[model samples]
Structures are given as C-alpha cells and as structure tokens.
Target: MCFRIVIFVLFSISASMAQEPQEYLDFILPLIKEAGKELLTADNYQVEHKKEVYDLVTIYDRRIEDILINKIKKKYPNHKFIGEEESEINGISNLTDTPTWIIDPIDGTSNFVRQIPFAAISVGLVINKEQTMGVVYNPFLNECFTAIKGEGAYLNGNKIKTNGQTDINKTCFTYELSLARNEKYGDMYMYRLKHLTRVIPGIRSYGSATISLCYVAAGRIDAYQCDGLYPWDAAAGVLIVREAGGYVCDSNGGEFNLMDPNYLATSTKKLSDEIMAIERIADEERIRDAKAKTEG
Candidate 1:
C-alpha cells in the first residue's frame, strides 16, 4: 500500500510540473536575454545566397540561435526545436507535433544589420504543436514581452492588457511593408495603407513584427497588419495580443495559425474586419491593374 501511494504522489508532482507555464517561462526568458546580449557584439556579419531576394541571415543571427538551441536542448533534451537558422542550414521545411521551441533568433535581420533598434529575439514554446509560452526581447530597447498560455501577458514584469478602444478613426495604425514595392502583394498593401491613413489619425511603421505586436499589447498602438510574416515572427506576439483582449487572424477573416504567412492583429474584431475590407478593395484594384496592363 505504501509503495503504491509513493508512486501516485510522484506521478502527481510530475504532472503538475509539466502543466505549469511559469516553469516553462523560467526556463526560456533568461536564455533569450543572454542571446540578445551576445548578438549585439557581432559586427562582422556575412550575408550569403538564399532562396528569397531580401531574406538575409547574419553571423549574429546564427550565434544567437545556436545559444538558444543549445540551452533548450540541454535543459529539455526530448523537446523539439525549430530554429530559423537550423531550418535554413538543414533545409528543413516542416513544423512538427512534438513539444517544440519556435525561435527567430533575430526577427528583423535587415533592421539588425542596419543597427536599427527595432529588431528582436523572438522565442516561443509549443506543446503538442500549440504555442503555449513566448518571450520576445529587444536588447537595444531593453524591453521584454512575455506570455504564458493562460496566465496573461507581461511587459517587464507588469501585467499588460490590450486597450479596449472601439473608435476606428481615433485609433493609431502600424503597418509592415515587407513585400517588394513593385510586386502584386506590395501594390495591394500600398492601396490599403492609403485608405487607412485617410481614416486613422496616425500611421507608423517600426519594421519589427515582434515589437509591433508587443506595442499592441502595451496599448502603444491600436492595430497592426502585414503580409508574409512567418510563424516564428508572430508566434509569441499572437498570444500576447490575444490575451490582451485583442483579435488576430489572417486577412481572409479565418483563424490565424502558426503556418499562415499573413497576420492582421487588432484591438477589436470590428477593426480587423474593416482592415480586411480595405485589403479586399486593394486586391480588386491590383487585379484591375493587371488586366489593364495586359490589354494595353
């Protein structure tokens, strides 16, 4: 009887440890901070050939990724990690169902290379392929945005929530113009921006996806939109935005998943819909433009 009771007690303790979000955050946050600090020391970054035109990977990016990956692997040897550099190095292209760490060592590589303050270290912990904990750190700004699945999001240890603002015309908009200006996607975004500027009081672009989402959580910005952002870029921020009483999804009004390459995160559902409507109009105009060019 005592043996059985001992086994039951051990199992209960193990389950509780496994289920805690704080436990995961305790393991992740410091590693991200350390990696971010080390990344700042990298001055000589070599950019090589890649599949995408503007996509770049620097030495600092790889070094930080290695640090994060090594730390996670050492602590949780069984857990899987899908890092941006590893994916590029190995040419691996799929996310798995195992407990995974989705990491963007430096989210805005272009900004990092240019010594811009908007780049960040984005780290997310996924359990059974679902994002559960995220830590986004910007060393240049000394800001940390963190979220644990149900425990709520935080900025520098203070509890953060989305400002529940409903006034669209009075709201501020943050845009990410990632796609090339001449591409069809770029044209669509341009038209949407023109419409948004006329409706909103102010528009801003910080060039960092993680920071933009963090800004939304902190109520610094009312809404943000972008096309072709990867899962690692927004995984942690998505949870932060949603937990702060904001809604985030793809442009089509569908549920946004980690795999989707587009995101429209806002303070309210109404704003999200309005933003999507503008996109639809821009898309229609792009189609019309293409047709006109062909006919001419």
Candidate 2:
C-alpha cells in the first residue's frame, strides 16, 4: 500500500510538471548550478578513456549525471530519462512517446579534464518524440544556454539570436577534427577537412559540441558541422540553435534527425545551402577517388 501511494504521488507530480512545462527550467537550473559548483572546485578530474583516446570521461561526469537523474526521477517519477553515464552502463535506451530527458552530464570531458571553459552539462526534454526544452550549462565559464520549444532561446537570462551571415567563405566554421580519429569514418572526415580548408579560410574545433552549438545560436560562430554524436550531445544544443533562429539540417542536406544527428547548423538557410553544396562536391570526389583506388 505504501509503495502504491508513492507511485501515485510521483505520477501526480509528473503530470503537474508536464502541464506547466515551463517550470522545467526552474527545477533544472538550480540543480545544474549546484553540480557546477562541485565541478568548478574539484581538485582531481579522475579522467578515463572510453572507446577512443580522445573520448574521455571523468568522475564528475558520472557524479553530476547521477545527481541530476536522481533528483529528477524523484521529483517526476513518471518521467523517463536517457542520460550519458546511465546509457553507457545499461546500453542506450530507446525514446518513447513518454516525456523523456536526454542528458549529457558533461558534454566536453576532454575540455573539463584540461580546464578548458568549453565543457558543459547538457539536458534536453523530449515529449511525443519532439525536442521541447534544452539547457547547456558550462559551469567553468558560467554560461547557461536554455530554450523551450517555440519560446526562443536565451543565454544567461538574456535573449540570443544568430548573426544571419550566409556567405560560405565569410562564415566562421567549426568542425570536430578529433573525431576523425575514428578508423571507419576517418577517411571521410579527412576528405571533408581537406576540401573545406581549401574553400574556407580556417576552422575551429573547440572540443565541445554543446557549447559550439550554443555558440551558433549566440552568433559567436556562424556555422558548425559534426557527425557521430550520441542523442544526448545534440538534443539540447540543437534545439537551442533552432530556437535562436539558426538553420539546422542533417549533414546530408536533409531534415535533422535527433537520433542520428550528423548536422550542419548555420546562421541562415543560404549558408546552409552553400556549405552543403560544397560538401556534396567533396564527397563526390571522395567516392571517385575510392573507386579509382579499388580498380587499381
């Protein structure tokens, strides 16, 4: 009977929170701040390697994720979660129609381990399979980027938007060069990097996908493209960028898919088109080169 009552109370709380979904920011922000405080002062990162050498994780990553998920599960017991650490341990969970939280306890563990300010704690809410709310907080830098579906995006409690740049060469481009280390995808990454460098002046890989996407939303960077990221990495930041009036699409010049998010985000549609055209040309060349090599 006690267990049944507890379950009923949790379900009720979740229903109430869902009704006034805007209250989500209120419930999550404080928890992020508290976790950030701990992150900022931790003397040792206790980092470890994942699948790749560049793929790093720290104690704070798991600890902060636990804190966020535990608090949220207790407060809204009926809700579901897809968190980075939990997913790592239990295998990635499938999204359902139920309201779900997608979380990356620390989005840039490499940066966090190095004391780089680009690291962030990312959380995004999905309802009926649509991304509805997002928060990416970089405790080391004290920047919090937030967005609710159709409500616009904000940074540090102030409204933010992209710069509306469209010229391909003129736009500031960002790419995650480190991911090119993947044995399977490295060749494609290399081709893109080579082709893009020849067209654009340079590129920036700031080591954090969440902050880089937030940067696009804030107009600090004009464009960002990355592939091979988990749902938690893109869920929050992608929504934030869209809310800030930026253009986002699957890296393949199609609609964005949160689950397989290889995306290109830009200040405007024109820029997205121009960049995608160039990428198509580069990929064509890559295919031709591979065919020639195979024939040889």
Candidate 3:
C-alpha cells in the first residue's frame, strides 16, 4: 500500500541519520590516535607566527592537517573541510551545510612548541551545520575525549560527566586570556578575572580551549570562558561538553554556533548563568568606559 511505503521511507531516513555519527566515529577514532602519536614524536617540526606574534603554527600542525584532509577527502569526496592551516592559507570564510570536518591539528601550538604538553589535536564533524561527532586527543596526557551526538561523552573510553557544581563561590573556573587577542577585550577579561578571583576558590587558564572544554566535561573545571575563537577551536569541545551533561553558549547566553567567536562553557546551566552574569557586568563596564572616552 502507499501508506506502508511512506512509513518505510520515513523509518529508513531516520535510521540513516542516527547511524551517521557512529559511522564517522568509527572512521575518525584511529586517525586521531595515529595523529596524536605523530604529534608526540615530532621534535624537529618548524614553528611560525601567523597574523600576530602570539598566534602560532607549527610544521606538525600543517602535517597533521594535511594527513587528515587527504584521508577524509579520499573517503568522503563530497564532504567539506575547514582546517585552521588550510583556512589560513586559502582564506576560507564560510561554513556550508554540506557535511564538513573542522580541524585544529594542534590546538595549543605555543605549548607544543615549548614542549609544555598541553596541546591537543581537535577534530569535529558537522553535518547539515550541526555538530555530530568530536574527538580531542592530548598526546602527552594520553587522553582521548570523544562525543557522538545523543550519546554520552567519553575520556579514554570511560564515560564522563560534568562536575555538577552550581555554586559560583565554591567553584573553580578557567578563562583563556590569550584568545582575547585584542587589548580592549583582554582588558575586559582581566576585569572579569579580578571580580571572579574575589569570589571563586580558584581560577586558571590552561591556554588550550579544547583541553579547557574537555576538563569541564571531565569535571576537573567547573566552567570556561573565552572570546575570538575559530570554529575548529570550539566545535569538538562544545559537543563534548553537551554530551557530558554540560552547557555551552555564546557570551550573552545565545545558542552556540560554530561561526560565533565567543564561548562560555560550564558544568551546569546554573553555573553557566552565574558566570555569564559576571561577564555581563564586565562587558557593561567596558562599554561604559568606551562611551566615556568617546564623549570626552
């Protein structure tokens, strides 16, 4: 009957959609491990500056990105790729609805260049502009953080969840100042930091957005905030946080989008609200200061 055919077609579409993330996971997990090994062993890789003196890129970053892009293109020729190095080279600015891989071959290039061991290779898959799979591997720590949409997040194959800490005063949080990249924004972040330090038990910056988000998912840090992040810097970590029962959004509490450059991630919605409240205050003060300067 026609009705039976319609039901079968709908079920088939639903089933295929459900299976896609897992299929991508199966393809990416081993690639992540292999890339992690290369990152850990590459000692002679060249380092370079990009855009600013503080923004760094290394030969390993390019090499790993090349490896991943090639393999992915070969396997899924129709899929798109948005890699940090490639974007830097080609000036790719738009993210399409076509299935895409957003990659940060080495997230903490400064740390990696200094042999600080806090770097990670972060990869995130987006299908129809929605994040579906994420893998962040820290070679030095041998930690692999992964998430599949609708499934729970995992660290080293063990299921992980956020700390569930709601009290701002009792919680420890991370704020990545390096990503501010602009003096005014950095000043605003410092202003927030001063307020946070007065109340929170502890504050830290791991200098790696991917690791900071993974730590939040693992319950190691209660929240993290940063601005001026690229899609690759945030795509994987945001999905992992959500899968681990955490919250991620823009600075003003809007729904997170990869194209948006700001992020506030927290272990719980309550914690996120509290942090964003402080950020709002700081932002207001920054706006007031700028207005005063313009008036004067």
The lDDT leader among the candidates is 3
- C-alpha RMSD of each candidate structure in angstroms: 3.1, 6.0, 1.9
lDDT for 80 in candidate 1 is 83
lDDT of 3 at 201: 92
What tens-digit string does per-residue lDDT give for candidate 3 at 1-296? Answer: 99999999999999998998899999998998899888778877577889877788888888999999999999999999999999998865677789899999999988888889899999999887888899999999999999999999999899999989999999988878764365647777766777778779988888899999999999999999888789999989999999999999887799887887588999999988888888778778878988999999
Off by over 4 Å in 3: 1-9, 179-184, 289-296
Model 1, runs deviating above 4 Å: 1-19, 45-49, 179-184, 292-296
Clashes of 2: 0
lDDT score, residue 149, model 1?
80
| Cα lDDT, all candidates | 0.81, 0.88, 0.89
In model 2, the runs with Cα more than 4 Å from the true position are 1-19, 179-181
Measured by C-alpha RMSD in angstroms, how accurate is candidate 3? 1.9
lDDT by residue (1-296, candidate 1, tens digit) is 99999999999998896677688898888888878777677767567546777788787878888888888899889888778888876753466766788889988888877888889999888786777888889999899989888778899999998886677888898988765433647667766777777778988888888899989988989898777667788778888888778889886678887876578889888887777777687777877988999999
Model 1 poorest ten-residue lDDT run:
178-187
- The TM-score values for the models, in the order shown, are 0.88, 0.91, 0.93
Better of 1 and 3 by lDDT: 3
